[model samples]
Target: MASSPTELPIHRFNSFDGVELAYREMGEGRPLVLIHGYFSTAMVNWVRYGHAGKIADRGYRVIMPDLRGHGDSARPHDPAAYPHDALADDGFALIEHLGLTDYDLGGYSLGGRTAMRMLARGAKPGRAIVAGMGLDGILNTAGRGGYFRRVLTNLGSFERGTPEWLTEAFLKTVQGDPVALLNVLDTFADTPREAVEAIAMPVLIVAGKDDDDNGSAEALADLLPHGRHGVIPGNHMSAVTRPELGIAIAEFLSE
Candidate 1:
């Protein structure tokens, strides 16, 4: 039987920027790195959902990283510390630290955008998966970014039923660092259309049918040189936990 995420041990590493990062490795075979979304830890996004286990059982080694300021990584609240490419840099740095090549890579939401940006920055993975993200969000993060800024700046002070309120609740649910996350929002990556198109790789774009937050996953997939769109059960918040999401990702990477 493949080892479950809970059964796997946690390890730590230092990124190029000197921030401490935590990660977990499970199963053994071809390497696949999965980055957890914003306001989430690797365990919550991948392990709790059984996504990591499912992928590992499919004969692939899974490496799940806790993004800076999330999970067990360092929280740098200084705005200047959070660069546009900081998240992607952490991912590619992890790959380089491991001396890996031709490995599979991807992420969800923030992680998805990071994966896309990493690819644009020349981290060539054998296969790629972008989940819970759309094209426009990657190209122009200002709108969504501004929303987060408002939530954090006011500390989720909006009235109930408002987007700001919901966002703040979600942020609290994950126990995120207020200042650090504010910077994450401020320095979100902006990957241009041309940069995305230059990736001559098999890319899987996973989206929740009801998720219109980032935009349409199908539309984003159409922009890739070799992109395939996948629909999974649940909205952005619930989709990560659905087994269907894991199934789609495994099938795509294995092919």
Candidate 2:
């Protein structure tokens, strides 16, 4: 039986550098590692919106991780804790810890970017899903990374109704740590075009109809050898909260 949203158990393990990371699991079957977005956790991105339940109900063991510096994971203040592609390193560590040799991988926004990093670094998930991300997001992380840096650096100053203000509001809603999140920014790495082209696994590049926040998802899909683009209703933020996102993912993975 699939676990109810509220019944999901939180699991912990040490990351590569001894940093404690957190993850939640539901259902039982072929493993599917689901990574959450920046300033978000497994609960908010997956469980709260019923995504995990929906995916799990489709016969998958949904493994959702709280990326370091976010959620219940260890938030190390030491700058040394965050190296280049630290989140990807943590993902690799999670795979090793769980011994996931023949599973699927997916993520949203930062999570999506991290999934790409993992694939580029040689993770061999049978299939992959990259949601709420686009070609620009993968090829050049600094544009979005720097935008978030400004938001964190100038938290309360943004005027209402502005994008920055909206982001800060979400940050407050999630109770994010500005300092640790800032450090996590150091881990962002630009994926080479060759890296993107080299990913031979079937990849579903799904994004919100109105989400061009990172770039063109269609373009990204076109670039991949076995990529396909799907659009759900809503923008980047709103789309994640919709059932359409989960439905699209379940449908694609089923195919």
Candidate 3:
């Protein structure tokens, strides 16, 4: 049986910018940090999917944090402040605050992007996994820019223009200021190609076989300096939910 949320060990740390961040710690070996995507909270992204327990079973200490402006963390309403660099800084702050010097890191979707940003900034994790995201920073720049513009244009027409399913999903996952999502999307547009190429650590890039928006998992593998690729049998969201996928991640990180 999965551990109940109340049963998991949770911790809080203060960022350099004074934001209070909440994180969950599990297992008991080499430390590993798990970052969730945009809109999704750490509990939903990591815990709900059973990744937390699997990592724990591997004898790896897992640290899952709710990024600032998401979940239990402080949500600042200023969209201009939620840049990728800032997100990377937040990860560094959490790791440093926890006194972890050589841990592993993994992220899904938006969190995966943040992981890439951390690598860009010279974060030296023992190993890393960038799941459900690709390293096409230049290509993503154009795609995300167009996507955010369309979202912004539709926000005012929320009731009439947005699909019911999408609205429901957004409402369920987004716990922070609405603008924070847009801001992060905007910041994603400016991610440089050089940054993607600068990552020197061994990286595992996992993507869904059906994830069309970010190109093929093979393509992402080709871009990394030391990247290995794996394909899970599902779409973007399903890739995060599947237990087998998490096991694959645990095995790779262990090696």
Candidate 4:
């Protein structure tokens, strides 16, 4: 059963770099950190999707952080500033800041990529879940190239109004500075494929049947040392929104 929103506790902490990081904490057992995907905030990705409360109800202290440059965190304008290592550092700093050890970490899309980077850097979690992501950090590189081109071409339309969910999501996030989006793209470009294979911890890889952007979950599952793959029946957004995904995640972490 899902816990009510009013029952959860939300807190904010400052990262080493001075960015204010916000996280939602709930439940009363093992600690788990939930990271959001690219262009999405923790509130939208986890709270709105019912992931925070759902996971909390299963006897785990769930922490959902708003990554730097997204959500309520500080947004630096330099494109070169948002490297994967820096992102990993932020994760570690948050864990250390909270004095947490042997906790679980989970992420989706860009967040998943960051979690893998953290593992490669020796930040060990009891278990990890990487959803809507693949071994290759780049989400459909060949396709993304063209897709980004279209995004750039249709910037005017997006700026005006496009009812397409993905487009609207992108537009909603890409505001303030196009450089931040480009920085994210460049950061993903530098993600090492070997990092996925280097992760020594047990991991759950979840993907939507229609999540063509990140490749299939099976592809991601094959990269982990110990990985379990599952497919939800929806596109990327819906996959995260559905309750089954949260239940599967909580069950996997419990094991």
Candidate 4 residue-wise lDDT at 22: 70
TM-score top scorer: 2
Tens digit per residue, CA lDDT, model 1, 1-255: 334456678788999878888888888899999998888889889888788888988999999999988878888777777776788888988998888986999999999999998999988899999999998888988877876777788974689978778878878788888888877775587888999889998999998989888888888899998999999888988898899988999999777
Supply the global lDDT for candidate 1. Answer: 0.86
The superposed Cα distance between candidate 2 and the true structure at residue 84, in angstroms, equals: 0.4
lDDT of 4 at 172: 62
Lowest lDDT block of 10, candidate 1: 1-10
Q: lDDT by residue for model 3 over 1-255, one digit each (tens)?
A: 225655776578888778788988777899999999776888888888788788888889888999877788877777656664677888999988988897899898878878877877788997888888765533465664455456544655556544434644564455545665556564563456666667788888888888655556666667778889988878876778888778878999878
lDDT of 3 at 37: 79
Tens digits of per-residue lDDT, candidate 4, 34-139, equal 8888777777777777777778878888888877777666667786566645677788889998999779998987788778777777888989988877655533
Clashes of each: 0, 0, 0, 0
Ranking by TM-score: 2, 1, 3, 4
Clashing residue pairs in candidate 2 are: none
Residue-level lDDT tens digits of model 2 in 1-255: 333688777899999999999999988899999999999999999989888889988999999999999999999889999999999999999999999899999999999999999999999999999999999999999999999999999989999999999999999899999999999999999999999999999999999999999999999999999999999999988999999999999988888
Residue 162 in candidate 3 has what lDDT? 43
Clashing pairs in 4: none
